[model samples]
Structures are given as structure tokens and as C-alpha cells.
Target: MKLHPVLVLDRTYTPVSIFSHKKAFILDLLNKCEVLQYYKSIKLSSPTMDYPAPLVIRIPVLLRHWQSPTPTRRAVFIRDNFTCAYCGKIVKDNNATIDHVLPKSRGGTWSWTNLVTCCNECNQKKGNRLPEEAGMPLLYKPKRPSSFQIALNRWRNKINREFLEALSLYGIIVDKKKLPEGSR
Candidate 1:
């Protein structure tokens, strides 16, 4: 009795609702919307019906807009590859936690630049102290997460032929070319 999940997006490209996968697919075929992914199906039924209906989960297509990624604990962990910023070790199995480079009490706000993924041990030891105060240095400088990058990350694992084709229409694709020196 697995159920499919769906993500609904508003006209402005913001996530607004989630629906059954079957409903999403139907909408896509009817030209009412676009499909983001085809997730596992779930059995659904009406109270008055004897049999269950199968549904698949999906995300709605959105209009293109230049927007920045929202800052969140999950986003930070993904952006850092679940690795501790100070120790450079990957955190897994529920051992990862979000840390602030500058303690919030010391005037740090919840933003991507000030937040990072850290192991429980590091977070506990670095409590309320700046990295420098704890003799720790960040392996990478943090910056606001990019919306395009976040979108790619979210869909990378689930991408398929149709998804790739659709994304390509928006100029999104994987490139292996090396940048010329001094380009940055």
C-alpha cells in the first residue's frame, strides 16, 4: 500500500502543494502542468469505493525565475556534502548537525554564509565560540546557496531521460570543460 508523493508549485515557481503521482501525471498529459519526477505509486481509494486507485508522486513544473536558494539545515548539509567544515570529515548516520561559524548569541543570523554542517562532537566542543576562538579554521568559505545549484542537487539522483531533456531546454546540463586560468 505504498503511496506516491507530489510537489505542487505556484505560478511564480514556488512550491505550493503536493499531490498524488497519478494526478500529477494526468495533469502533465492534459497540458495543465509539467511533471518533475515519477515517484513510487500508492494505493488510494474513495470511502464509497471498494477498490483502491494507484497514484504516483510528482513535482509540478515551474516558470523560470532568478531566485536564490533558501537557507535550511538540509540545504547546508547537502551543500557541504555532509562533511564537517572544521574537521573535514563526513558526518553520516544522524551524527551531523548544523553549526554557526559565528555564534548566534554573538550576533550571527541564520544564513548560508554563517551556517555549516558539523559533526556532533565538533558542534559540542565549539559551542558558542567562533572558529578562531576554538583554534579551528573552516575548510571552505561559505556563501549563499545558489538556486540553480540546489535544484540540480535535488534532482540529480532522480533525473531520467525526460527530466534531462526538460532541464536542457532551460540551459541546464552537465559540462566537463575546464575553465581557463584567471577566468575567476
Candidate 2:
């Protein structure tokens, strides 16, 4: 099936979610969102299909970026998929601690860019030494994550199936795509 997808952007034009063409058209018709781009062709054959096919739409308002959550131990755990950056262990319980990629004593501050989820053994072994100094390499670099980033991951991994079914109930068909990845 030809799944015509539409990208939904915030009023600022930052992509926050994606919807099917039907949903996009509804948003346009309801004047709830503004069309930013149109698909190259008009494929809708219904008598009600008077509007252009939208490739991108912008919500009339923006969600709060100011109150987006700051990085915390739990947030870091969720961001990292609860996997250790050094040993790739899927840590459960309260056994995880946030480790500084660059040790704080030498320079690193407790920021997302500098911190990662690490287990007790690895944390103890690494100590205050840098990864290179201790001959331990990071599995992946850390990053500062936003609410959008976290939401996308949650949707992709857990909520997507339900979202698709729910959209189907509403007669919308969102084209599923791999979420854009970032360092974390």
C-alpha cells in the first residue's frame, strides 16, 4: 500500500510528531494547523477532497520547551535504555548510577553531555580517571536529550502499535518510520 505520510511540526517548524494524510487534511480543514508543504500530487479521489495533499503541517501553537525536563538519574537511565555504556548490561533495580564520562575532579560537570548510566562495578573501576586514561572506552557518547526526543523513543518502542490502531479507528493511517537517532 502507498502510505502517504505527513510530518507534523510545531508552530516554530520543529517536528514533534507525524500523522497520516487523513489526519493532516482534517487538521487543515478544521483550521487547527497550517499547511507548510504540499505533496507533489493530488491523489485523494473523494468528493470532499478539495484541499491539497499535505506533506507537512504546523500546529498553530508550540508546546512548552522551557519546562522540558532536566537530566536526572532516572531520565538518564531511560535515555540509555537502561543499558550500561561500558559493558552493555541491562541493569535493573536501583543498581544503576550516573557516571561522568569525563571525571568531575579533573573538569567534567554533571551535564547530560558528560554523564551516562553505569553499573557499580564499572563505576568503581573507572574511578576518577578519564576513559582513555583508564583504557576503558565508552560504548556511545552521551547527549542532552529533549522532551521531544524522549517522546519519540517512547512512541517508537512502546506506544506506536496502540497509536496506529487508535489512528486506524479514526480512519487515519500514519506511515511508520524509524525515528531519527542521536548520541545518547
Candidate 3:
């Protein structure tokens, strides 16, 4: 019951984080946040009255500073949806290897635009070679992902569909089809 997920939002209603229901309810109790939505109508009884469990809550100040994930192995794989850049094969992150789009030997750097995630087989096949040289081509050009994009992509699966729908009402569209097969 307490383990249910809760979406935390800023005063402006931008999503800030996901907290457990217990913490979210605590926030409501402390007057730190206002409940915006409830996961269920079923309420918990206290000495005073019924407390509706929160599924989403909003705070009272703008959260201008949003935390973004740094570019790392897991970040790259998640950003790429664990798909090979050249072959578009859906694979697990454990099986994915970071490949330099322009081979490091050819002066490629380890930045987002130059790095892509691929399966070990593809990495071996394309070893130190340009995609074209390896008779393969990238399915899409890589870019440095925004922190919001990175976090969203990371917790994509953990996000409830109802929460996503609620976000949609605020004009945030998360398209999973443009990404790999396994992602929502």
C-alpha cells in the first residue's frame, strides 16, 4: 500500500520526481504539497478523518533547477534504448557496447554525437571503422540528450500510463515509437 508510486510536481506543475505514497502523504500532512490526484478513492482512516492517498502532488514554488543525468554508459544505452545504432537490433543494456561513430583512431571524441550504443557483435563488426566502411549506416543521428530527456527515458517503464496521460494534458508528449522496440 505504501509502496505505490507518486508523481511530484512543482508549483508550475512541472514534474519534479517520483516518491513513494507514504512520503507523498507525509508531504500533504506537512502542508508542503497539495494533492492533485489520487490513485484510488479508497481512503485511510486517522483519528481526525479520511486521508486520500496521493498519486500526484504539487508544491508551492517553481523548481527552476532540474537535475539531468550525466552522459555515461548506462545513460548512453538508455538514451539509445539499448538498440544498435547501425543494425537497429533491440538488446539489453548489459549486451550493449558504446561505439564511436567516427572511430577514435580517426579523431572521434567520446561525446554524445560521436558515441552510439550497439550490441557486442556490431561493435566487433564495426571495430575502429566508420559505419559506411563497415557496410552499415546509423539508423539515426545521435545528439546530446537534455537532462529531462535522459531522466524521462531512464524511468520510462516505471512511469504509470495514467501518469503519462496526465502529463499529456499539460502538452508533454512522450513518443516511444520513435525509440526502440522494448520501450513504451
Give per-model TM-scores. 0.56, 0.56, 0.73
- Compose the digit string of candidate 3's lDDT tens values, residues 43-148: 6668998887787789898766655446688889878977789889988857889999998889998888988999899999988889998998899899987665
lDDT of 1 by residue, 1-184 (tens): 4324344555644544335556665676577775444433333455775332322223344534525667888888877767799899979949999998989899998998899999999999888999999988899998875665654454344434443443444454644222123211
Candidate 3 shows a clash count of 0
- Reference-based lDDT, residue 37, model 3: 88
Put down candidate 2 lDDT per residue, 1-184, tens digits, no spaces: 3445565677776666666778888888899999767765545556765556777678977867723658877878877877788988878847798999988887888788998999888899999998888888999899877665554444444333433443444344433643323211
| Stretches of model 1 off by over 4 angstroms after superposition | 1-27, 33-66, 159-184
Q: Give the TM-score of candidate 1.
A: 0.56
At residue 74, give the lDDT of candidate 2.
80
Candidate 1, poorest ten consecutive residues by summed lDDT: 175-184
lDDT (C-alpha) at residue 88 in model 1: 90
Where does model 2 exceed 4 Å of error? 1-9, 17-59, 64-69, 154-157, 161-184
Q: Candidate 3: misplaced stretches above 4 Å?
A: 1-5, 16-23, 26-32, 41-51, 59-68, 176-184
Higher-TM-score candidate of 1 and 3 = 3
